[model samples]
Each structure stands twice: as C-alpha cells, then as structure tokens.
Target: MKTFQEFGLEPKILRAITEMGFEESTPIQEKTIPLAMEGRDLIGQAQTGTGKTAAFGVPLIHKIAIQEERIVALIMCPTRELAIQVAEEIGKLGRFKGIRSLPIYGGQDIVKQIRALKKKPQIIIGTPGRLLDHINRKTIKLDDVQTVVLDEADEMLDMGFMDDIQSILKLVPAERHTMLFSATMPSNIQKLAQQFLRNPEHISVIPKQVSAPLIDQAYIELNERQKFEALSRLIDMESPDLAIIFGRTKRRVDELAEALQKRGYAAEGLHGDLSQNQRDNVMRKFRDGSIDVLVATDVAARGLDVSGVTHVINFDLPQDPESYVHRIGRTGRAGKEGTAWTFVTPREIDHLHLIEKVTRHKINKKPLPSIAEAIEGKQKMTAERILDAMQSDAYGEFKGVAIQLLEQYDSVNLIAAALKLLTGEKKEIEIELTPEEPMRARKKKFDVRSSGRRVGGYGSGGSSGGDRRNDRPGGGYGSSSGSNSRYPRKDGSNYGPRDGSSGSSYRGNSSSEGRSSSPRERDYGSGSRDRSKTTNNS
Candidate 1:
C-alpha cells in the first residue's frame, strides 16, 4: 500500500501514475522497482493480476535519456495480446518522460512494424516470433539495448520460444542488465535463468488466497456447439445487474458481444486492439452502468478495478489457473456477494478439475437453464417492474388509457402484451459464432477412481480432449477459412513441419499452420496437434 513516490520514482513518472489513478503500488511493483532501478538482474514470480508491467517499466523508463534514439530496453512476451498490453502500459508510464515504446507481433502488418522501427523508439515490446522476423530482416537492432527483460519467461518456454529467446539474448550487448519474470519457477524456467542472468535477486508474491468466499462459483458442462444458446438462456435466467464476460481472443470478444446485442443484451466489447479513447469510452459506460454486460479479452481486463459487478462469466475458459482467478476476481468486491459461471466442454472436464486443484476450491456444477425456465425468470422480473410502476405516482396520467384498454381486453391479457413489449423476444435469436479452439490445460497425473471418477491430466484416453480443432477452420485473426491447416508461422518448428506426429513441444506456435497428426492426437496446453490428417514432420 506504499505510494509510488516512496519507491524513488522521478516527478514526471509519478505524475503519470497519479493521473492514471494508481496512487499505490501493488505487491510485485513494491518489491521490484527499487531493485530494478539499482541495475540488478532480478527474477520476480507473481500471478497475472499483480501489476508486473510497472515493476519493470518504471526502471527502464528512468534509465533512458529523453533524446536517445537507440532502442535501449527490450521486453519479450508470449502473445500479441500481452505484448500490446505491455506496450500501452509502458507508454503511459513514460508519457511525460518523452520515452517511446512500440509493440511488434504476428497477425499485424510486418510492413507497418518496419515503418514503426524507423521511428527509433526507445523501447520495443514484442512477441518472440515477430521479433525473430524483424531480426532476420535486419529491421530491429539490439546493439545498444541496455536492459533486456524476458517478461513472463515461463510462458515463453511454454509457448516454445526457448530458441528464439536465446538467440535474441545473444544478439544484445553482453554488458546489458537482464531481468526475468514468471508466475512459477519450473525446472525449464530456472535453467533459463541460470544460463542467462547474473547473480540475480529473486522475489515472489504467491497469492495464498482466492477470490472472496461470498462469491458463488459454478460451471456448466456443455458441448461447444450449444454454448451460445446456453449463454443466452443463462443471461435471461440470472439477470445480472452488471456483468463481465471473458472471451479468449479479440475475435471471440467482438463477435460474442455483437451476437449478445442482437439477442437483446446491453453489451460492449473490450480488447487490446481498441484505442485509448475507445477503451476509456467503454470503461465509462461500464462504470455508470450504461452497459449491463462487458465482453472482454484477458489482456483488456487486466488491472481493471471497477465495483458493482454482479457476475463474471467465462464464456470461454481461460488458458491458465491464474487467468481463471483473475477473471472471477472482477466481481465480489467490498464484501458484497457476487457470482461466477464457466462453460466447460466435456473433454475439458478434467481441465476444470485441474483448476480446482490449483485454487484448492471445488466449484459446484450447475444445470443449463431451459428456454421455458428463462422465460419464467423474465416473467418474474416483469412482474416486479409492474408492481413498482403500480406503486409510483408517475403513472397517474396513463391511468385513463390503462382503464380504456382494460375495458376492451381482459386485464391479464393486456398486462401480458405489456410484458412481451418490455422483454422483447427473450429467446430464440439465431446467432452463429465462428468456433474457437478450446484452451489446453496442463496435466500433472492421470488416475481413475473406483466410482468412475478421473482426475488430473486423464492421459490420452476417455475423450480426445474435445476434438473441436476440426471445426476451427480459421482460428486466428489473419488465417483463411479455406484451410484448417495452420498458416506458415513466423516462429518455426512448433506449428507444423517440425518433428512429425511427435508434435511441437511448446504450446503456442506463432505460425499459421497447426500441429502434425496421426489417426489420434492430443492437445495439452496450446501445442500444435492439428487433426489435419497429414503428418507435420517435414
């Protein structure tokens, strides 16, 4: 709870943080800023919502001179969404300091990145694959980089960026200060740190608690094809005062919000692709309760501190346990009770258990609401509205019309018409959302109990981990619908043509092409296990 000024930050940076409404430093920021500013190589271990960006950003910004043109600080991330989010936050921290940072990632135009590189930004926040592309083309030079940070180091290893990360590090000046951050220091991550960092300081903030216990947690076991219908019905049933719906990607958020609106929900979408003005506008509406539901990607929801959110729905399950905790943390603020619901495909049932294992809390299973049930819930809400209207003096002028209508029509029938008009087509709206590949959860061990219960990874049996990859023709933004085959990715080896059906060891392949396949394949994490029916080992 200490102030930013207590960390020895300069006046300009302090001003920026204050303007951003961040008067106090979060746990990770409190421990990291002083050490990072001392030019010490450090390893910080913290969960997703812990404010790691400013932990590294403030020091990097303070070290750079105003007019220095060379890119002095380099930050690497695992996803384009993460890269963009980091860059935007750093841009704010350095706004008055005259430091500039640019984000480079796949799916965005490479020509556009090249143009941006020409502007001589002082910092570059990029994904490994896209950074390698720029390196191969000789567009980005790290010769002058004074500080190189491997932000989310474990994620890079998880995503199969070990080689790229090593190569990028080798290219930077040998004397540079290096820092690495991860949520957990697994064997691979520890090895990377030992190989790359100096006698680095280690810091960690493992959250020992979960969200408020007053919040109700539940999950709906359903099929992917029927998820939207279930979601529409659930909204009508719950009637949240304010809701936040978490989607996995930008495309998913945009489409889901649009479809929800078409189905008669007051909703808006928030993602990293939006400009600051647009994000601000959306946040404004959400705060004032103008929009009842806000559909968002994880990157967009990070560090958002709004109260009065009654429900948080994971329309798509998160990739990690940390992300799941963050999504649900949006609600249950200030001792007020809240509720959270997750939609889990059958194959992902074990994955849900994995989340339970991590958080050490069992989520209750809930039945999907039926259409008639949803209508009944709506009818109750309408009746409440009618009662409130009947008590209020504001309806005095309309009494004559109400009497006249009752004379011609049955009183109950006239009220039914009013209810229908108010609710406006509560169910049965056709919406087609392009299917997204289900998230892959980590595996620890698989076991079968005598009562027909399976826990942990559940091995390669039972179900093919919900083989919905075939339905995802174009999973990402720039991919084409003509082929389910992953596009040729910028980062090689993981997506396709790597080592046959053995598949890519890493989770995310920055390429367009997917994984190799035999008659049967498994998706653990986001590793490419393309069911393309063709071998990917070139």
Candidate 2:
C-alpha cells in the first residue's frame, strides 16, 4: 500500500483525504490513481468496499477546474442509494477545491434536481435511467463533459440498463476519458468495453477467494423447519452488535423481519417494493444502531456502505457465487474482523459446496446452538454488563440495597438473581416462516449475446422461483428474470407450486401441512426447563 501523498495529489485534496482518515491507499487505489490521472481509459475489476470510489473519485476531483461549472464529469450508477453515496464521497473529496458534485436519480423529484442543476455543479453522479431522462428532456448537457465513469457497470447491466448506458455514452464527446468499474467482467461488459474504450488498460484487484480474508465463514446444516430456531439461537449466542440477514425473496425478507421483531429483536426489512422514503428510513435506523438486524433482498442491499456491520447471516442462500461474495462483503470491511453464517438445508448441501468450490474458500460446519447454550450465552452477556457497571462505579446507588439483600441471602444467589432479572427469559413465541425451496447445484455457462439477462446464471430475482417482473414493481433497472424450473430436486419431486399456496407448515418440530397449537404448547417447555432435550433435528 502506498500513501496518498506519494500519488502527487494537491495539498488541499491531500488534506481532505487525511481528514477523512485515509492514511494509505488501498490496492485498487494504488493501481488506479496514477493511470487514471495520466488521462487513459481504464477498466477496474474490484469488489465493493475496496475503496473503488476513492480510487476513481480522487482523480476525478483532481482534474475538475472550479471555474468551469457545467457538468465537466458524469458518473452513472445502478441504484439511487449508490448514486447518493458516490456523490457524497466526491463532495467531501472536492470540498477544499471548491468543486461541486450533484446526484440525480429516480424516486426523487425531478424538479428539485433541475433546480440543483441551475447551480452549475461541475460533476454529475446519477443512475442510468434518470440520466437518460434528463438527456432526452434537454435538462442536462454532455457537450462539455471531459470525463465519464460507469460505476458498478455490471450491476447496471443486470438491471437492464445497457441500452441506456450506450445512449448516454454516445452523447458524450468522442474524445474524452472513460473508465468502467465492475466486480465481475462478463462477456457483455467485455464487449461494451471494446466498443466504447480505446484499448483501455484492464486492472483486476479481485482476490483469489472472492470473500474477504478477515471474515470467519461458517455454515450450519439443518432441516427447513429448523432454520428459524437455528437462527434465533445463533443470534442469542453471538449477540452481534450489527447484523444483516439475507433472504431469497421479498416475501422471505418480510416474514423473517416480522418474525425477528416478534421475538423481541429490533429488526427491519429492505426490498425493492419499498418506497424510496421507507428504504431511507430503514437504512437510517440500521446505520444509527436503533436496529441491530437488517433483513434484505440482494438487490435492495446492493451498493449499501454502512460501517460497523459485525455479522452477515444468510437465512437463505444466494443464487450464485457472485451474490454470495457480495453478501458477505457487507461485513469485515476496512480490515475489521467479522463473522458470516449460512443456513443450509440437507438437500442444499451440494449447492453450498458449489459456492465453496467457486469462491475457493472452505466454509466450516457449525453445530446448531442448543437452547440451553443460548441461555448460557445470555447469562454471560449479563455478567459482562454487571462487571462493566462495577468498574464504572455505576452501582453505587444500589450498593445499600445490595448490602441489605446480602445479609439475608448468599452473595452468589443474589448475584444470580440479578443476572436473571437483567437477562429476561427467552420469549416462547411461535414464529412461522414461509419455507423457501432448496437450491440445486448446477453448472454455469457464460452467454455473451444476452445483454438484458444475467450472463452466466440466474439473476437475484430469479432465485425466488417465480415471475421476476412481479418481484420488482415498475419494471425498473435492477429487475432480474429467470425461471425456477431449471433445477429439479434430487428426489425427482419438483418444488412447490409458485401459486400463493401454503406449501407446508414450519411449526415446532413438525413439517405437517396444517398448524397445530397442541404440538407447539407441548414442544415449548416452561421457561427453558425442557429446552435441553430439543435436538438439532427438532
């Protein structure tokens, strides 16, 4: 890693970078900054959290002349959230130089963006759809644009934005700097680069294993009916400060979030069906620690950059290895150690293995945590809290009452009572989740001709095994299409019908069709008394 100052950055820019706590350049930044500054077209292949934003942002900001106010540079992203995030980072980098960047995206008032355009920002960061809209409406001009960046180019292709990107690129000046960044370079991306870039330098910073090395990866094999219980126990035992739970479909995200909240956990769901404002609120709460768990679909969580994410839980497996890499990449950022756990049904073991083989990282098997273990973990947490209070001398006011009780009862028993009161008994809530069909392992093939579809395998939306159009409302970019019938179960039995039918009931220790109250009452023993008997199979 090289220092930012070694890149010959302007003093003001270096000052801003230093203030932002960027002491050294990441691999992507070290390799990209010099080439990009030398006015060459380039393609950068790197995953999220690799500091790609700054890798491109620094040079873009450095090149901007504050005197020329009319959109000198344009950056196109796939999602509104990403557009906003990139704009904010660029804003910080350019603050000292008096260069301005404005973010334009859909789901916000176009009138407001048009007004902001009047202020003559030197840079424009926007989604492909909204950018093309502005182009057609003559609200934005690209005649004077000197630099163009396509951030997350592959993501835009997944969302069916290739044509829009082409149209936008055609409008830019013929002789100008162009840079494309993507996590994976599919045939479509390669063809696009060949057509648009003039012998661009290709730089790949992807690790041998796509997953971050700092992430401790593991998986638990259990039955479909046992997943919720397994997840609850893991959360109890791990007690992650902040966590993300990935689900396969919109319905799955909703059900899991609701079930988690019902169990007295602070959680919320993020998916495409949410309005922009609702999505913003959920992300805000998760970022501010008001909520500890975020349940999200793959597309909804795309390009999300939140710090302090301690854990990533795959309640349902991703559709492909790339998506798996993206899911875990949310945690273990900035050289911080994090944990990731995946729940695999017995039938889906081969699929999990497939992910492992492709990513070249072995996922260790973890036993399902017993209910008694969860209780013990809670007691440990309570003890830590008590010890912290003691160290802080915060128990001074309660010392008199403690002394009074100590005289009457054994000190150990009184301490146990305090732990019990602080660590409330686990709620015996019957959480019902819609069981997702297990994924089957299959070989992937790359298709170059398919620009509108996923190149190698199913899109994120296709993993739901239903109509992709219905999963994403408004037919917006980032909507993926595929059929679930491609892979059949090993038992020669097909998955449940996609029709909104209750395929099976996931009641306590039962996989029967209909719900039974008596079974749950019998299974949920009184106050963890019989919980030790609950095995992993249960």
Candidate 3:
C-alpha cells in the first residue's frame, strides 16, 4: 500500500512516477525499495508482471548521482529485449530526475551504443553478452559502478550467461550494493547470489495467477507454418474487440503485422529496432482502436498499458515461462475475463510443460477451428450485433429502408443479406511466412519419440493425423533432408507422379504450370478466391 513518495524518492522522481500513473507500490517494490534505497544487497523473487523493473529501477535511479562519470548503477539482463525494457522503465522512472540510462545489447550497432555512452548516463542497462563485448572493447567503464543489478538472474543462467555474469561481477566494485531479481531461484542462481551478494535480504513476491484464474488459456497444436492460418481462424472465431499477438523475434513481429494487414486487420508491429516515437505511435493506435491488432515482441510490448485488450495470441510460443506470463498479462485486467491462445509447434511441447510447471497453469488443448466454423462465429457476432441494434432503438433511421427492401425482397432474404454484410465472411488469406528453424526438443529419446507421435511427427515433417502434406508442385517441402525425390513419379522423375499417358517426365516448372492453366483458363481457383475475399473485407 506504500506510495512512491513514501519510498523516499526525490521530488522530481516522485513527480515522474505520478505522471507515469504509478500510485501504489507493487509488493516487490514495497518490500525491496526501502532496503535497496538504504544501499543494501537484495534478492527479489517475482514474475515479470509484478512490476519488478521499477522495484529495482526506482532505488537505483534514486541513489545514483547523475554526472559525466558514466558509473553509478549497472543492470544486467539475459536478452536484448529485457535489457531494452529495463532501460526503458528506468528512463521513464528517472525522467524528471535527469538520471539517464542507456541500453547496451548485441544485434544493435555497437558504435551507436558507444556514442550514447559518451553522453555519460549514470545508469547502464545491458544484456550479459553485449555488456561483456563493450567491456572487452574498452567502450564502457565499470570502475565507478556503485550498484549492480542482475535482472532475471535465472534467465541469464538458463541462457548460459553464468560465466559472463561472473566476469562482469568481477569487474564491478565488491563494496557496491547488488540486487538480483528472478522468477525462480535455481541452485546456480543461489550460487551466483552467494558469490556476489553480501548477505542480501530476500524478498519473494508470489506470481499473480493471471493465466488460469481470470484468463482462459488454450493451445493450438500446429505445425510451424500452419500457425498463421490457425491464428487468422481464431481471430475470426473469437472476434475480439482488441487483440495482442506476441511473436518471438522482431522479424516475426514485422511479418505477422504485415500479413495481418494484408488479411484486412488493422495491425502494427512493435520491436526494439523501432524508434521511441514509432513505438509510441503504434501503442497510441492500438489504444484508440485505429489498429485493432498489435503484433509485438515481448521487449517492445513490456510496460504497455493498453486497456480493453480482449485477447492475447501467442503466434510463436515464448522461450521462457516469464515471457509467457507477461504476454498473457496484457489482457484480463480490471477483473475482466480474457482469452489467450498459444500456437505451439510439435517440438516445443516440452517447453510448454516447463512453462506450465513454472506458472502452475494447465493450458487446455483446443482444436483448430475450421474455416466454416470461423464463418459461423462471425455470423454469430453479426447476429448479436443486429439483435442489439434492434433492441437498442438504433434501427429507427433504417426502418424506412427496411420497409422498401421488404417490398422488393422477402423479409428473410433481406435480413440474410444484411447479416452477410455485417458478418466478416470466411476468407482464404495466403500468408507466406518464412519458415522458422524447428524447435529442438529437450527430452529423453523415448519421451521425444512418444511426444513426436502425439503431434503426428510434425517435427519430423510428417502429416498430423489425416492432415497430409499436399503433394502438389508448390506443396511444402519437409525438413531439408527429404526432397521431392521422396515422392518420385512413375517415370522415375523427382516430382510426384503424373498422368499415365506421360511421354516424357513431368516437368513441374512454373512455366509449365502456367502454360497448362493458360490454354483453357476458366478458373483462377484459390488465388482468385483469396483475392476476392480480401477485396470484400477491405
């Protein structure tokens, strides 16, 4: 129940905290802030959504004296995403105090980060890998670092950053305060604390039961490529007023946003590569319903507060349990119920179990709804909308039009037509997502084999149940090992078998396909159908 002001933060920082709309301290913040502010080592065990960033960030910002020395508080994170998120949260909390923070991570330009470091930010937030990179290159100095924080310590251990963390810790002053925050404290994390932390006061904030309590969580067991189609179908069926789709990588976010836009959904992508202004604009659009769907990476979506987000879709399953919890937390706020759907590749089932163990939430297995079912779902939405309009007295203006239309057509026909117009009819969208590297299973050979059979050998490029891999010319290739030669023609050609009267081998070239279609082209088939549906929806 403590407020930011009670935490003894300076007036300017307090003012910024109020402006940022944080009135009361979260459990982790309330317990850890005072101790951290007193310049003591602390360990906080909390999940991602418990507002742990500010728990450590506030005290770090408060204790630091902003100057050109570029040495005050250091935050080390496991991933570039988390590093950027921690830096962003620190930047927000320290805005009025002028206690600047810079994020250092790989995949971004090191020269730019070095140039930013020239600004002499008092706080440095960096991923373990790139922080070490900067230290080795002599671009960053840690001699004056007074406080060190290892955010998501367990994640760093999971990512095999233990050695790098030890090396980084060695570079910092031993007398400085150290804070470690992690969702789970494995033995390695405990060892890390013993080695570096000086009798830290432990604070454990129990993770909120967001997934199972207020949110309905389900998984669609799908192939990597089929995820998008399944997502589109779910969106149609669910008809969520607003939705957030989480993708694993920035590229995935970009492609998903683009593909959703092509399929007539107003969507935008948010990631670390985007400028602050760009991220703000995307969030703004999401809030105002200018964009109904937000496609984002976890780092970019962190700390976002978009209300009325009815659904959270995990286009790709997150790599960690904390991330899964964070992604689903976007919805089901303010005691409202929300739904979350995660698209799980066959190989990542074990990872899903790991997540279930951490979050203590059993996700239900949901079959992918067929296109016809999606249409029915949309029609149901339209039916509800129509009935509500009729009951709410919003049909007064259309009364005369209805009467005139009734004279020309039967009432049932007219009503059906109106419903069709209102409904978002089924559409076939050809989403061409670049295949992601298959997830590597971490299980015993017997476990892997059993799990593989359950998901229909999707990881091994075999069909799931009766869902055969299409053997057409443009049909998908299985894992790189098996080529089209696996389905050889009767004439010993690499391509699938052709007609019985074939003189030469069936040359399944693009030109040959086009020529075959050109002679008596009366049908464009799925391509035209998809395009027509897209145009109608638009």
Question: What TM-scores do the predictions have?
Answer: 0.75, 0.59, 0.74
lDDT of each: 0.74, 0.75, 0.70
Q: Give, for candidate 3, the lowest lDDT window spanning 10 residues.
A: 529-538
For model 2, residues 241-334, the per-residue Cα lDDT tens digits are 8999999888889999999998888999998789989999999999999999999987777668889999999998876676788789899998
When sorted by lDDT, best at the front, the candidate numbers are 2, 1, 3
For model 2, what is the C-alpha lDDT against the true structure?
Answer: 0.75
List runs of model 1 lying over 4 Å from the truth. 15-23, 79-81, 105-112, 127-137, 158-167, 186-191, 210-214, 271-290, 299-305, 319-326, 347-361, 387-427, 442-538
Model 1 CA lDDT for position 481: 52
Two-way TM-score contest, 2 vs 3, winner: 3
Worst 10 residues of 1 by lDDT: 518-527
| lDDT, residue 80, candidate 2 | 53
Query: Over the stretch 251-349, how does candidate 1's per-residue lDDT look in tens digits?
Result: 789899999988778999998889999999999999999999999988788768889999999998886676788789889987999999999887667
lDDT tens per residue, model 3, 1-538: 8988787778988887876667899888899999998988889998766788888888888877766466788898765556656777788888887887887754444556778888888888877656765786687889988999998888666544677789899999888999999888899989999999999899998864625488999998988768788888898889889999988777778888998888887789988888979978888888889988998887777667778999999888775676788789889988999999998877667778777877878999989889888888788888988888778986789889878888999889888888888875445567777555433322321213234321101122332212112422233533332322222211111222222233212222314223232211111111111111010000
**Cand. 2 TM to true fold:** 0.59
For model 2, where is the 10-residue window of minimal lDDT? Answer: 529-538
